[model samples]
Target: MLQILNEEGEVVNEKAMPDLSDDELKELMRRMVYTRIWDQRALSLNRQGRLGFYAPVAGQEASMLASEFAMEDEDWLLPSYRDIPQLVFHGLPLTKAFLYSRGHFMGGQIPEGVNALMPQIIIAAQCTQCAGIALGLKKRGKKNVAFTYFGDGATSQGDFYEGLNFAGAYQAPAVFISQNNRFAISVPVEKQTASKTLAQKSVAAGIRGIQVDGMDPLAVYAATKEARENAVNGEGPTLIETLTYRYGPHTTAGDDPTRYRTEELDNEWEKKDPLIRFRKFLENKGLWSKEEEEKTVEQAKDDIKAALKEADNTPKQKVTDLIKIMSETLPYNLQEQLEEYTEKESK
Candidate 1:
């Protein structure tokens, strides 16, 4: 496994560290703090029955943010539902995230200039889509690359293989990141695959493969930076398996993790929490301080509140708009249904 920082928050590989400016480090930390606040606020909204459903991104901060930090604004980002932080990092507004979880129709719209798709709700669906997007970029001779995020369980899906296989054969400019959080809801990683490492799955596709400590932002940043460079240079796709953990239930809906794993196990991972280690690293560099962290926390809270208020202000989802976004010119039969639903709901 590639590890740049040890569990005790010490850098063990300065030679392999990512070339991140001090300002970028602070930005990365701010994004992680912002994500945590969003997760907590989302839970509160869900419990109050104000939001439909949500998947928390609390524990996978380094796994999500650092890799995305490697991408350019022109690159394409494909994501699963829990990848809201990366999507927001790519250009989606914080308020749009709340709108999305609340099921507002406009939430699905990608903001202009953000080269990303709406978060895929299906497992591993974005993997194949990412490959296709990358292939398109290659055919068009674009300098941009494509990146997608999936989980450990998704490795079991057919889309994962199909995407990788095609990307390899065509030498597409793509990066596949699998955040192996150790569980596919209830099924443990040991039971999910017999392979020694998820990254090795790329061997069948003839691409670069790497396994890294997902809890280490520096490591993820370095690995993804290398992968992105390889892709834009026509070296082909890379499969990166990030060994990480999720601290919360799969979704905010009714699910009990205690029935599947031990609280002691979760506590163990907490000691290596991404934020704590990265915070310590920045503090030691005199780039971060205790008071600075508190200010970040307060700023996150206020921003989250404003986002929630914006979501609350959005017009409720309409039957017409939902159907129309699916097509510019509605099909003949569906047009009637849309009219009926809109008439009924509008009343």
Candidate 2:
């Protein structure tokens, strides 16, 4: 496995560490800390019925954020349902994220210039979409790559192989990241596939692949940076499998992880928590302090509070609004439906 920092956050492989400046390293830690705060708050909001349909993203911070940190703004991102952080970082607003969780139709609409799709709830759907976007970028002679994220269970789907094979055949500039967080809902990764490593599955599609220590932000950053470079250089796509674990239940949607996972297993992965590991590494370099962490925590809380407020204030979407947004000029059927709903709502 590719590893730069061990469980204790000590550099285990100096040669493999990315050449990140002190500020950049600290920023990475800050983002992870902020994301942790957001995850915690989101879960509480979900429990209080203030938000709808949330997927907890506690422990896979390094895998998700570090990979996104490696990408440029011009690159397109196709994210899974659990990848709200990547979308927000890639230019989607936090308010929109909250609206999305609340099932607002506007949440699906990407703002002009934000090179991303809405969080895809369907399994592995983004993989195929990412491949198509990458191919389009190549044909347009753009240097940007299309990056995507999926879970280990997504690899078991036919769309996963089809997407990779299409990208390989066309040599599309795409980087596929598999955040293998040990379980797909209540199902374990082992039952999803027999492949020794999810990364190796890329061989069948004639692309390069690597497995990285997902809990190690430095390792994930280095690998994703290299993969992005390779893609933009016309070396075809790359599949990266980040071996990580999610600390919370799969989602806030009636999932009881305790039913499928053990306390012992959870404790084992807790020792490798990305936030703690990265915090130690930053402190060792005198880049992070409790003061900074506390500030970040407060900032994250304030941001979430404001974003949720914005979402709450947005006008509730109506059936007519959904019908109208479907097209510029609605079809006869939709037009009739829209009028029907509009009149009914007026009552």
- Candidate No. with top TM-score: 2
Off by over 4 Å in 2: none
RMSD of 1: 1.2
What are the per-residue Cα lDDT tens digits for candidate 1 across 66-132? Answer: 9999999999999998998899889999889888887886788899999999989899999999999
- Candidate number of the best lDDT: 2
Off by over 4 Å in 1: none
TM-score of every model versus the real structure = 0.97, 0.99
How many clashes does the backbone of model 1 have? 0
In the order shown, the candidates' Cα RMSDs to the true structure are 1.2, 0.8
How far does residue 65 in candidate 2 sit from its true spot (Å)? 0.3
- The models' CA-based lDDT, in order, is 0.91, 0.94
After the best TM-score superposition of candidate 2, give how far the Cα of residue 154 lies from its true spot, in angstroms.
0.2
Locate the minimum summed-lDDT window of 10 residues in model 2.
Answer: 184-193
* Candidate 2 lDDT tens digits, 1-347: 99999988899999998989998998889899999999999999998999999999999999999999999999999999999998998999999999899999988888999999999999999999999999999999999999999999999999999999999999999999999998888888888788889999999999999999999999999999999999999999999999999999888878999999999999999999999999988889889999999999999999999998889899999988889889998889998998899899999
